[model samples]
Structure formats: C-alpha cells, structure tokens
Target: MAVTLQDKLVVALSSRALFDFEEENQLFEEAGSQSYVQLQLTRLTQPAQPGVAFPLVQKLLRFNADGQHRVEVVILSRNDPVSGLRVFHSAQENHLQIERGVFTQGRTPFKYLRPLGAKLFLSVNESDVRQALEAGFPAARVFPDSIKSAEANPDEIRIAFDGDAVLFADDSERVFKERGLNAFQSHEAQYAQTPLPPGPFVPLLQAIHLLQTLPANQVPVRIRTALVTARSAPAHERAIRTLMSWQITIDEAMFLGGLEKGPFLQEFEPDFFFDDQTRHCESAKYAGPTGHVVHGVANPR
Candidate 1:
C-alpha cells in the first residue's frame, strides 16, 4: 500500500522558518545562491539555531512517540537541491524526526501543499505565505528573529490564534477595515446570533480539539488552545457564538479591543501565536513565537 499523510497533522515549513538561516539568507540576498550554497556546504556540520517556530514544532512532534505517528513536518523550501543537504543534516543533528522534503530550487513551494495535504504552512517569506493563504491553506509568515517560547512546560503544548481572518472568516474584519469600528460593531451586533464563517485555521483548531479530547493516558502531551483577538464586547459576541456553533471549546479567549496583545500573550506563553496582521505579529513576537497569517481584506492586493 502507498504511504499516506491524510490522517496526520501535516505541517509544511520553509528552512528559514524551521531554523535560523538569517546569515545565509543575507548572503543569498547579497552574493547570490552560489555563495550561499558554498557557505552552507562549508558549515554543514554546524547545527543551525532553532527559528521562531522551533519550540512549537519540537513540542508537537513529541506526540508521535509510543508507536504512534500523529504529526508530520516537512521542509517545503525554495533552496536549491544541493543546499538542502544542510537542512537535512541540521535536522538530523538536532534529532528532529523529519524525513520528507520538497526543494523547489527557486520556484514557489506553496504549489505542493495540495499533494501533501498540509493543514499548515510556515515560511519566512511573505510572498510565499500570501500565496499559500490564497491557495486556501492555513499559512503564516514566521519572524525568524522572534523570541521563541520559553520551555516552561515539557509535558504540554500551548498554541494561540487570532480570531478574525484566522480561526474565523474575516467577515467582521472586512467590515471593520472598510467602514470603521462603529459600523463593524453594529454589523456584528445585528448578526450576533449568526455564527461567523469558518476561516483557514479552523481545521487546525479542530485537530487540536481532537487531541484534547483524547484520554490523558492515550497521549503523552497535553494540548491547550486560545483565541486571542482584537474584538471586544458586542463584537466579541459573534466570535464566541461562532466557536459555540462549531462545538469547539478552547482553553482561553481574549478580546483586547485594539490594545497591544503582546503583554497578554506573554502571560499565556504559547509555543506559537498566529495572527493576520503585521502590527499584531510585531507586538506578539516579543511575548513568544509569532507568525503572520497574511489573509483576508487586511492583506488586499
């Protein structure tokens, strides 16, 4: 029988998002691919530091122990095939159980998400992230320099997501962006009984929810999720009702009302946080690992 990833929690991420390739990336930017490849070859034995999503990926893979493979992480990168040797070498050095990869050599890698059945894509390139989201995948642009989550809890995995344009469709966000806050609130108020449409990250949330429902003895690690959004009060009602409709219950929810999310996120200390706007991503990174969803009307062409 052919191998399949349909049952796995598939995540495809770029080399930059998985490990710190900033120095090599800068080289590729200034001196071109040849120089970058040569440098990588020379330093193939040196393990690259973990990137922003490192903690999250590391913690998630922990679920695969005890003869179970619940998670699958792949390297979907634009690096040339020759340069990819280093990526695999680094993974090996770090003991990351990643065996699959797609090196596009220069092309957009988002095209392969369909074949992989990937539920999430994380890349350092904004364009790739936008392309993936446009292709209907839950994708995010990771900040390579963002502070990785402190490993305070080894037996649990914590994740957080922005509400609109993330776990829920950007309907309210579109209204807010085009008609201002008052109209956005009123629109949500008028339709408080109606659940917001599903967004790209819903599948991810559902997957996590499934893991949470498993008996504690069945899984080695605990999973906790939170809804961190800018919506508050009347607008917050629609977001809550939407989750209620889906029958998914998260551990926590925050409606900051245009306030900085960084401080609040710090208290939660998620291994990773995903948002759809640059402003929030910037602030959230300081608290923990952060990624930009790059979706909805907020990221219009």
Candidate 2:
C-alpha cells in the first residue's frame, strides 16, 4: 500500500507564486543564485508576505479540512534547496499546511507534475508555465502584482476562467482574430450544436467538478466556478453547448463580448482568474489574483 494522490485534486505551485519573493527574485536575477540563497537564508525566519495566489491556495487547502485528503498542494520550484527552506518556513508561518516540495535549483520543474498527478500548475516563470502548457497540463503564469482576494466569503472558493483559448480551444478565437466579428459569430452560430474542443484548463475544470460532486460535508469549503468570456450572444451558445457536452457545470457565465472584464470580475470576486490573452489578464489583475495562460492564437510569438 502506498500514499496516493490518485483521488485528490493536486495543484503544483512555484515558490514565487505562493509567497512574495520579488526582492529575492530580483537578487537572483541581477546578482545570481548565490546572493539569492544568502538573502533567503538571512530571511529564513521571517515569513514572506503572501503573494497574489495566496488566498486561493488557502481556500483550496480547506478541502482537506474534513480529514478526507481531497486536495493536495505541492511546492514545485526552480529554487535551490537552501532557498526552499525559506519557502517551507513561510508556509508554516502563514499557517498553510503545505508539507510537500520539490526544489530543482535552476531546472524546470514542470515535468514533475505528471508523477504528482497535478491537474493545475501555477508559477511566476513564463518559460516554465509555457512548458507546462505545451506538455498538456493546465498551467498559468501568476501576476506577482495582482490584487489579493477579499477577506469576505471565507467559506467559499471562487475561481473564474476565460472561455475561448482557456477552458475551450481557440478555434473561434482564431476565426475572430483572422476574420471579422461577423465571420466569427456566423461560425459559432452555425456550429451551435457542436461541442467546442477542450482547452488546457479542461482537466483542471473536470477535477474541480469532481470535488464539487463529493459529499457536501466531506469538503469544508464550497467551490464556485465561472466562465468569463469575451464571446457574446450567438457565439455564447456554442460555449454553453460545449460545457453541456462535457457535463461540467459552470456556476456563472459572463458573455462580455468585447467589454473589459475587470469590473465584472471585481463584482464576481474570484479568488483567482485565468485568461489566455495578456490584455484580459491585465484587466483582471485589478479585480483579484490573475494568471496569464499564454497559449493559443492570442499569444502568437
């Protein structure tokens, strides 16, 4: 018999995504790992400030509060072993029960997601996030400066996602980008009955759905998910149909068309928001913790 994450919703997080490490990161960038290691060592006893994704992680860990082990959060970082000591210490000081970690020094840690059975990966490193996405994992590069989640709704875990190029494949997004809005609307209208292809975040959504299906008393916190997309009216039908086809229920769906998503998301008050386009993510950061899913047509290199 072995300890298993098979039945858990596993999330792999980078050190920087979990705590405020900008100053140390800057040292690592300008002065290299040695200086960074020294700085982390000196600050080892001081708990780092919570980063953008901190609130979300706190709520997610609540799933395990019922003593069922329904959720697992692991530190998968590029920092060396010495730097990792500070990360663990910060988690302890912050009262987060994060117990597992993998310190890879300067190496990319995305490859470890598979063995960990992680459904989601959140990191501050763009290169690592991109690599995770390319490898078919739902990953996002967290905005370090994004607004923190509100203290209200302590019992609920609110998460929001962009529709096209995030939860759904960017086929419609490609059409919209290449042709005019008329063509994109027409395409979606014609295929209203057809289920849109799944995107990178689909696995993460399914995992959440699974957690939602668990007995209400088995999990300490409630999960509320939303699809906040730019698609409107006629095009929205297909996105709805796609989720119906997958049998996944989104608690809220905002068809914003082309309006800015920031205000709407602020009202939604999600613990975290994910969007493929940097523009949407930029707007969303003002609302709460935002992650840049640098995938699909909008992220052309």
Candidate 3:
C-alpha cells in the first residue's frame, strides 16, 4: 500500500519560521538568492537557531514520540535545495524529527499543501500565508521576533486562537468594521442561537480537538486550546454557540471585549496564538509566539 499522511496531523512550515534565518534572509533581500545560497552553503554545518514558531512545532512533534506517528512536520520552504540542507541539519541539531521537505527555490510553496495534507502552515512570508489561507488551509504568518513560549508546560501543547477570522467566520467582525460596535453587538445578539460559519482555522482546531479526545494512554502528550477574542457578553454568546454547534470544545475562552490581548495571553502562556488583525498579533507577540492570520475584512485585498 502507498504511504499516506491522511491520519496524521500534518503541519507544513517555512524554513524562516522554523529557524532564525533573519540574517541570511536579510542577505537574500539585500544581495540576492545566489549570495544567500552561497552563504547557506558556507554555513551548511552550522545549525540555525530556533525562531518564533519553533516551540509550537516542538510540542506538536511530541505527539509522534510514542512511535504511533500521529503527527508529521514538513519543511515547505522557498529556499533552494542547497539551503534546505542547512534546514534539515538545523532540525537535526535541534533534535526535531522533521523528515519531509519541499524546497521550492523561491517559487511559491502553498500549492504543495494540498498534496501534503497539511492541517496548518506557518511562515514568515505574508504572501505564502495569505495564499495558503485563501486556498482553505489554516495558515499563519509568524512574527519572527515574537517571544518564544514559556517552558512551563513541556509535556503539554497549549494553543490559543482568536474567535473572528481565526476560528469563526468574520461576519460579525465585518459588521463591527463597517457599521460600528453597536451594530456588531446587535447582529451577534440577535443571532446568538445561530452558529457562525467556520473560519480558516476550523479544520486545524477540529484536528487538535480530536487528538485531545484520544485516551491518555494512547497519546504521548497533552493538548489544550483556548478561544481568546475581543468579543464580550452578548457578542461572546455567538462565538460559544458556534463552537457548541460544531461539537468542539476548547480548554479555555477569554472574551476581553476591546482590551489589549497581550496581558491576558501572558497569563495563559500559550505555545502559540493566532489572530486575524495585525494590531492584535503585534500586542500578542510580546506575550508569546503569535501568528497573524491575514484574512477577512480587516485584511482587505
């Protein structure tokens, strides 16, 4: 039988998002791909440092530690095959068991997500992330400088998501953006019984929820999730209803209304946080590893 990733929670990530390639990336930006390739070749033996998404990836990979292969991590990079050598080496140095990779050599890499059965995609490149999200896969543009996750929960994977645009459709957010908060609040309250549509991250969240439901003895690590949103009170009801309707449960939920998400996220100390708006991501990054989901009305084309 042909090998398949159908049952595994596959996460496709870019090289830059996985490792600290900022200096080499700057060289690529200022000089060119050739110079960048040469530099990577020169440092081929030196492993790169872990970047923003590293901790999250590390924890997710733990699901496979029991030899059940419940998770798979793929390097979907724009770097050339030469640079990819360095990436794989870095993974080895960091003790990450990443085996699959697709080095596009500057071509767009999102197109490969479908074939890879990727549940999530993380990249430092906004274009790749937006394209992946547009293609209906959960993708996030990781803040390269975002603070790393706290070491408080090594055996547990904690992920936090924004409600609108990240986990639920941005319909209410559209109203909030165009009409005003009152209209948005009214819309959500009136449709409190109605479940909002699934956003880009729904599939990923569903997969995580399924993994969390596995018997403790069958899994290698614990998974916890949260819904941290700006919605409060009446507006919050719709978000909760939506999750209930989907039959998916998160470990925690924070309806902060319009408060800055940073402080709350700091307390939660998630391995990663995903939000649609860049402003929210900006504040959340300081709390822990954060990704900007470039979708919905707030991120207009």
Q: Looking at candidate 1, what is the lDDT of residue 159?
A: 92
Where is the poorest 10-residue window by lDDT in model 3? 149-158
lDDT of 1 by residue, 1-301 (tens): 9999988899999999999999999999999988999998898788898888778888888888867888999999999887788889988988899999999988999999999999899999899999888888989989877887546678888899999999988878889888999999999999999998999998788778877888899888999888999898988988888999999998899999999999999998888899988999999888888899988888877
- Give the RMSD in angstroms, all C-alphas superposed, for model 1: 1.1
Number of residue pairs clashing in candidate 3, backbone atoms closer than 3 angstroms, sequence gap of 3 or more or interchain: 0
For residues 1-301, what per-residue lDDT tens digits would candidate 2 score against the true structure?
9989988889999999999999889888899888988898899889999998789899988887767688889999999998888899999998898989999999999999999989999999999999999999999999999999659589898999999889999988999999989999999999999999999999999999998887886777899999999899999999998999999999999999899999999999989999998998999999999999989998776
Scored by lDDT, model 1 comes in at: 0.89
lDDT at residue 22 of model 2 (Cα atoms): 95
Q: 1-301, model 3: which lDDT tens digit per residue?
A: 9999999899999999999999999999999989999999999999999998889888888887778898899999999998999999999999999999999989999999999999999998899998999999999999989999647688888899999998988887889999998999998999999999999999899899889999999777799899999999988898988899999988899999899999999998989999999999999989999999999998988
The pairs that clash in candidate 1 are: none
Please, what is the TM-score per model? 0.97, 0.98, 0.98
Stretches of model 2 off by over 4 angstroms after superposition: none
